[model samples]
Target chain A: MNSFLTAFFAGTSQGAIYALVSLGLVLVWRGAGVVNFAQMGQAMFTTYIASQLIQNEYSYWSAFVIALISGALLGALVDLGIMRPLSSRKNSLLLNSQSMRTTIPVIASLGILGVLKALAGIFWAGEERGFPAPVPTTGLRLGNTDLAITGFDLFVIGVVFLTLVLTTIFFTRTGMGLAMRASALNPEVTRLSGIRVGSVRTLSWAISGTASSLAGLLVTPKTNLSPNTLDLLLIVGFTAAVVGGLTSLAGSVLGGFILGYVIAFVNVYSAPENVFLAILIFLLLALFLRPQGILGSKEVRRV
Target chain B: MLKVSNLVTEFASIKALNDISFQAKPGRITTVIGANGAGKSTLLRTISGLERPTSGSITWFDEELTDKSVEAIVRSGVAQVPEGHAVISQLSVAENIELGGLFRKRQARGDLEIATKDVYELFPILFERRREPAGSLSGGERQMLAISRALVARPKLLLLDEPSLGLAPLISAQIISIVDELCKSTGLTVLLVEQNANTALAVADHGILLALGKVVADLPAKELIADSALRAAYLGY
Candidate 1:
């Protein structure tokens, strides 16, 4: 029974990190109409910055904050420097096809991932390093019994919940949030309403970057940090997003928990190698049974 | 007044607006009527800065609006209700109205609540359905919501493109009459574009008839309405 409880707590904490990463992916997809395949690369680069700061004797908290800010600036720069210029050249022969117009930007993002990974390798010499958790990792005690969840696990859950609440409020209660939603729905019409669509898009990327940075800071303590450290998390986060329906934020959270529990139970009962196979099966099931996602709205045909 | 001179817009080798020149006087309804391919929509797009003019200039009350961005033109007090009542479907009707006043100058933003209330008064149906998603509204209600959204910005000049499209005749007449009433009472400058010639001409102070990306006739509304030969040649009515 203790073992079962431990696995459950373990799954919940890990799932929270996946939820944060998935949330970032959904934000960029909704706000900019791109899948953002390079999200983990961006996160990895920022995590390295945090790692460097820690090695230089900087406090973890201050380094964490700086890494988030750097992530935001980098995200804005990516949009302004690459995506904007690419989208502006409408007369290019390579972008003539409707499919190509969508495909090219995705390809560009993959290229960005490669460049970031290469840069990280050069700067850090592809070193694997340990990250310190702010809170204690030992299990908490309830009377004489030790609970399966640690102080760090509790912190992860608390941060993820707070982030979700804050994000929800921003979207529902703020003017800029409304503008972002409006831009996502119909950018041209939003522009006509005197809102700067480009700025709103850049802001979306910034917010997305912050989310990714938060995930990196939280998850790195569980594993070693390297240029390729976040690559697996990206895949798991994407599966979570696909399960939740890419269009719905809350759905992403739910999807993350589902995958987290699945991973935990599989590890407890079966070989660890089956984890990837289980995830693949889950993704294929989601695609085949509900392509719009568990919470995604079906495309309504208005005659 | 809005003055567009020698305006030319091209899409590939085809000229969408070729050397188009016209003047829309302030505080009046100047309707541009044409057939499907007559470039009526493109003219509004160019004036609103959604599309760049290949040549010539567009000036509004001595302000050169030729090279400004869409947001800049909108901030300069010109608002457009694009064709097909392009409301943000996922947003509530009230949110859509609020979006219009979002980027208004700091001083003007104080009037948002009053402006919203006024639009509610103008279209009580929208008020009743303010919290509902805009996509759920009927076609006529959506058009009303679109106009209310543009009005919330307190634009001095309104470029309404095909407000009557896909609407029943009764609803269409009601929408146009409301616009006509607003123009007269508020002294708002209106450049109305429509394919429905008779309805537009009846409500307009002046009219411009277009064909194949060129203006064929520009005259007082009544004169253009009475000119059977010119109407037959271009408008097919």
Candidate 2:
């Protein structure tokens, strides 16, 4: 029973990090209608900046802030330099078809992932390095019992929860947020309403960058930072987003928690080696049962 | 006044608008009536800066509007209600209405509130379902929401494309009559594009009949309606 409790506590923290990463993926998908395969690479690059800053004796908080800013700038640069150009190539034969239009950007994002990974390798020498946790990692004590969750785990949960709340408010209450939602749904009508759709797309990328950066920073302490450190997380986060429904932000977060718990239970009851297989089977089951995702609306097919 | 001179819009080799020239005087309903392939929507799109003309110019009050961005054109007092009642279906009715006035720099909170109140008064059904998602609305209500959204921008010249596209005849007539009332009461310059020639010509003050991307006749709405031979030759009515 104590072991069961331990896995539950561990899963909550693991899920929070996944939620942050999933949130970023959903943001770009909703805003630009393109699945970004390079999300983890962007996160890894920004987290490395934070790691380097800390190694140079900078305060953890300051390094964290700088990394987030760098992430936002990098995201905007990617959109302006690569994604935007790729999307606007309407005259290209390869991009003229509807299926090709979505597929091509995804391929471009994969190319971006390769470039980002290569850049990180060149700059950081592709070395695995430990990242320090902002909060202590020692397990909390209650009376004579030691809880499985640490201060760092609690911190991760707090940060993810706060981010979810803030983003919810922004989307519901602010003018810019409303414009972003509007543009995502219908760009032509949004442009006709005097909103610059291009600017809004850029903003979406920036925010997604920030969210991914936060996920990177939070998760690095548990594993190790390297050029390819976040690759697996990206896959898991994407699965979570799919599970939640890519169109719904709240759904992504819920998907993360479910995946996190699944991972933890698989590790505890079975073996860590079977974790990936379990996740795959779970995803397949989800696809078969609810293809639109657990929270997604049913698509009304027009005859 | 909105003046379009020798405007030619081409999609590659085919010209959608071929040397289209017309004038829409202030405070008058200038309806552009045509068949489906006659380039009526393209004209509204060109005027609203959604499509770039291959040649010629669109001028509003002598201000050149040819190559301006869509957002810039809206700021310059031209708002288009696009075909198919293009409302953001996921958003609430109130949010959809708020989106229209989002870019306008209101001097005070009261200004925005008043603009919103006016739209609600015009479409009471929308007000009743303000909190509901726009997707839940009927087709006619969706059109009303789309119009209300454009009006919130407080545009000087309104460009409506196929406002009566898929609605029933009674609902279509209701929407057109409301537009007519708006033009008469507010002196709003309107360029209404429609495939339903009889309905549009009945309410329009001035009419331009189009055929194969060229203007067949430009006359008073009454005269255009009365000329059966001309209507048969061009409009196929």
Best-matching candidate per lDDT? 2
Q: How much is the lDDT of residue A142 in candidate 1?
A: 90
Q: Which whole-number lDDT from 0 to 100 does residue B106 have in model 2?
A: 49
What tens-digit string does per-residue lDDT give for candidate 1 at B1-237? 999999999988699999999999999999999999899999999999999989999999989999999999999999999999999887899899989889863677668888889999999999999988899999999999999989988899999999999999999999999999999999999999999888888999999999999999999999999999998888776
Model 1: interface root-mean-square deviation in Å: 3.6
lDDT of each: 0.90, 0.90
Give the residue spans of candidate 2 off by over 4 A: A298-303, B105-109
* Each prediction's RMSD to truth: 2.1, 2.3
Compared with the true structure, what per-residue lDDT tens digits does model 2 show for residues B53-85?
A: 999999999789998999999999899999999
Give me candidate 1's TM-score against the actual structure.
0.97
Please report the TM-score between candidate 2 and the true structure: 0.96
lDDT of 1 by residue, A6-77 (tens): 779888989999998898898888888888888889989999999999999999999999999988988888
